[model samples]
Target: MGRILLAVVALLLPAHAQEWRLTRSQSLTQEGTRAWRYTLSPADRAGRELWQKLVLQYQDHLRAGYRVDLGSWRLYFLGGRLRLEPHCPQVNPACFTFGALPVEKGVQDRFLLGLSQLLDQALAQARNTGGNLTLSGLFRVELKPGQAPPYLARPSGWAP
Candidate 1:
């Protein structure tokens, strides 16, 4: 029986290994890679709830404005404000936002653009509701493995 129990535990180890965690934006303040990526796992109930609310709001925004779909997505919170890139970043015209662009376009340019806006709003609302440590808009950072990120600008408020 002990041998069987030990085997079962070993088999379950990998399944339990993937836990949710937030990679603090402050920790990745440095220069190195072109961009940094973070995760918003299911374990983060508050974050996930906020994300769901933002999704509904953003979908409405897109449908009312551009008439586009929000597609599948992943979330990350970095330290900075969103800004519109004057020039086209690549082939995707959707990548060029009227306000600010995201750090990485990933293939779904339009969806990401719309989602970022919603994320900004949700973070602000969350902060106001209580002292919740909610994640805000994602900022561009090039944190090297060992180096710290330099001083960066925070969003002036919310984009009008």
Candidate 2:
């Protein structure tokens, strides 16, 4: 009886938990602007299916007037619609840009603080170069199931 119960419990668990693996990355600079591109892939077939489901759910939430917050970044559906391109292997791999922040006073310092939490050494190098250098390289980051999701709805009363 115990063995049967254990088997049932195991079956109740998901076959593949969501895990996004960084597959490719590249830093680019064009016309004095710097940006980084990353390509994330699932660990296996099950992960791929899970990723698709999450994307659909996220879209539905957005349609319902939910705002997405990634760390300090905030995104809202403008004009009642937000266009997201489909992820295509080798062509377009789910792009997310995080730079070109507004030049308002104190904005750069805050942005750098948030960035430093993610890549401390990179920011250190940039500081050493008198802010002329920017992060440029491919980095590996494994997203486990318990970690933060790709994005989440902003909490009520949240500021900055």
Candidate 3:
């Protein structure tokens, strides 16, 4: 029957092919450096793999657009045994090794572009998994030169 075939196909699909969400984020401006951290829910191997290749190989593309005033920055992510961290000496004092990608100054565009691609991958996975896409709401990041990024301490989402 048609329903039986559909059920069988669903059973063969991967879990990540169903949905992705932004589960957590950590932003820090420590020792004169800034870093924002976020993890995707339902992490997928394919998504991580794509980031490894695209981010690691983005140097040439990034060098073409590098600007000194933008300051140095790095974006990193783990892909299986491989880790991709874009280098930016002008901005980042030293790279952080934790499982995060730092976007140093001047590379905001690339960071956004990269995030969009990753999100697209998540969307596609949802389609493949026979699940509807769900978007995580926007989050605000408060930045200071030498302080931990502020977060909403109360339910109203106000920072004191």
> What lDDT score goes with residue 70 in model 1?
20
Candidate lDDT values, in order: 0.33, 0.33, 0.32
Q: Which residue pairs show backbone clashes in model 1?
A: 29-148, 29-149, 30-143, 30-148, 30-149, 83-100, 84-100
Off by over 4 Å in 2: 1-18, 27-35, 69-75, 78-160
TM-score of each: 0.21, 0.31, 0.24
Q: What is the C-alpha lDDT profile of model 1 across 1-160, one tens digit per residue?
A: 9677547644643433232233433233457432333322323464445444544443344334432222221222223322222232222234332222232333223334334334333333333332222223322222234432221222221231
How well is each residue in 1-160 modelled by candidate 2, as lDDT tens digits? 9677546534532321123333233345575533333333444675455434434444455556764332223344555433222221111111122233234423322332333233323223332332221111112222223333222222121222
Tell me the lDDT of model 2 at 61. Answer: 54
TM-score of 3: 0.24
Clash number by candidate, in order: 7, 0, 4
- List CA RMSD, all candidates: 17.6, 17.9, 18.3
Alpha carbon lDDT at 133, candidate 1: 26
lDDT of 3 at 151: 18
What ranges in model 1 sit over 4 Å off? 1-34, 38-43, 66-160
